[model samples]
Target: MLKLLNQLLGLFCCFLMTACSSVPKLESNAIAPIVKLPNNHEELGVMSAYSDPWEGFNRRMYYFNAKADEYVILPVVAGYQKITPDVVERSVHNFFSNLDEISTFINSLLQLKLFVAGETLARFTLNSTLGLAGLFDVATQIGLAEQNEDFGQTLGYWGVDAGPYLVLPLLGPSSLRDATALAFDNLVFQQAINELGLDTDEELLISLIDGVDARASLPFRYYASGSAFEYEHLKLLYKKYREIQVAR
Candidate 1:
């Protein structure tokens, strides 16, 4: 249930970001700065030079994945207008709150002092049960506030630094550290899901679809900003945003 809720909430957040923004003219020049291969360009360059076949394969797969994401997932979500920007925003907030409680729980078990876990269990439980499965704001009434965390933040907490920025083929922009964190998080999640007896291929498929849906639901408020440099603008904004998240 938590997984599904998270997926939906994630899609809502993505949709909000995409839908709220106006499409600006795509400018090749705008890409120059953001895409300028960084100092560690050597890392990616080495991969390409020494492992041309693998790099090519990865690039193809990435492009296919991005195409699938934009063409297949985005439209399905665009059809779900009833979700609404307001509801998506609120659900996102509540979802984060619930996760904060869960993170607290995890941190407690892991002996991490970075965050308090499990204190919000009562609130989460109540909200999940009485608040119509976390679609409402019941948890807020009791002051069990929401805190958001992701694999990137987890990595930062463990002292991993964000290494050079890289635009992943289909995954989009992420740093080396953030990408590694993503993989680690997936592994952990897979193990947990397996332990819960819900890690079948079908289950995984549903989860992926849920994730895409969640992303698609986010309003693209910035897209329509009437900026000629939309792509670069978003790229810069997201880089800073992710960095802040990692720092936190």
Candidate 2:
């Protein structure tokens, strides 16, 4: 048991180092600050207006994530990209995306966005069957565009305040509301996997593949933003992005 626990910790630490939130009234000021760059672009007063109450812990986590990404996750991702054919990679992405539509559909319904829910349902149905288990995104070709909805957004839609900007280990940026939402989503996902009769080993394999695939798809690199205050900028971006998502 101890050996297994250590292995899991090591694996999570590897992920934590590789990458890199939120909220009150779901307001911008509560979670992040508006970053203003002067004409010379040399001065940034981001921290002065920033609302990262957990700045000490958050910055430490960010530093750890960046270093891990540089040494571990990025290399693994690069290797995966190198060995996998483009077409194959896209199919893997599509397959997972089709699975994600299930969560999105449910969240959309919870948020009372019936149209989006229906659309996601159609996308899932079409892609699962005609798209050959989502190896292809046939739904998008016909105008059933993919919609991004999650439990966090559902919470935001229901007026749950983002508790604070939180940097989650291994998972990266999130707010209190979003983090709770994430736990709920994970429970739902695990239940679905169980319903599908996936064994524990099979489930773990799929999760690793999903994580690798996700990392490959993301173009963002830690510390690559060329800013001394990358943490502040990332915080602001995440906050603003969630704001838009919740508003939508």
Candidate 3:
């Protein structure tokens, strides 16, 4: 009887521990205070004011994207609601690899790294050809690992300090130096776009469609989180991750 009682007690304790572990903790909605600009108060003030419209635009865009993401993820969650973390992690890794290849290709062309550019071009072409136009993973098979360098990293490479944090409309988080770098990058991209001429509209349209499709692909992962707060937490995590990448 004592042995049976002891077994019962152990089972009860295990139940209590499992229940405790399943309880969700309440999280506070506190964000770190943004850093300020030095010796550029007036300029920052103007930029801040200008940024207001963009913030609204970005908020709307974010909302739309969130809604679209929810729609895309619904079917996935319905079928794979209990998918393992390792599987989800692999999907994230694959997504980043695809993005990195695109970034590397653009950067190599702009930076005039002929060898790197050639490699990127070859990788991109092969991926598009065999990977079903970059919707698959052909680059990984050929040993061409993805590489990513944003405008912020480009600026950092040139010894630019990341000035005060500035949240721009539609574009999201950025620093002063990064904003300048973005403008320069956009200018270069525009030159390339212009060089392609009127006949390239179909290609441009296809590229834009591909971008939208890619953005829509991750909605299910966000939806599985169960709340807006959880989604925002994930976003902040991504922001911090990107900032670390820039700093490096």
Indicate which candidate wins on TM-score.
Answer: 2
lDDT (Cα atoms) of all candidates against the true structure: 0.52, 0.75, 0.48
lDDT of 3 by residue, 25-69 (tens): 336875534764356554443223222234454456556655654
Q: Across residues 1-248, which tens digit of lDDT does each residue of candidate 1 receive? A: 22322333344345334432322355976654565545655454312222222335544554565576568656666664445576775675555444345544554444454334454566668877878756677867878665555566666767777665544654554556777766655555555445446647866764564454455545443235464444434444445565565565
Per-model TM-score, in order, reads 0.55, 0.79, 0.45
Ranking by lDDT: 2, 1, 3
CA deviation > 4 Å runs, candidate 3: 1-138, 161-204, 220-224, 231-235
TM-score of 3: 0.45
Clashing pairs in 3: 54-169, 128-133
Segments in model 2 whose C-alpha atoms lie over 4 Å from true places? 1-50
Task: List ranges where model 1 is wrong by over 4 Å.
Answer: 1-70, 80-115, 118-123, 128-137, 199-202, 221-226
Compared with the true structure, model 1 gives a TM-score of 0.55
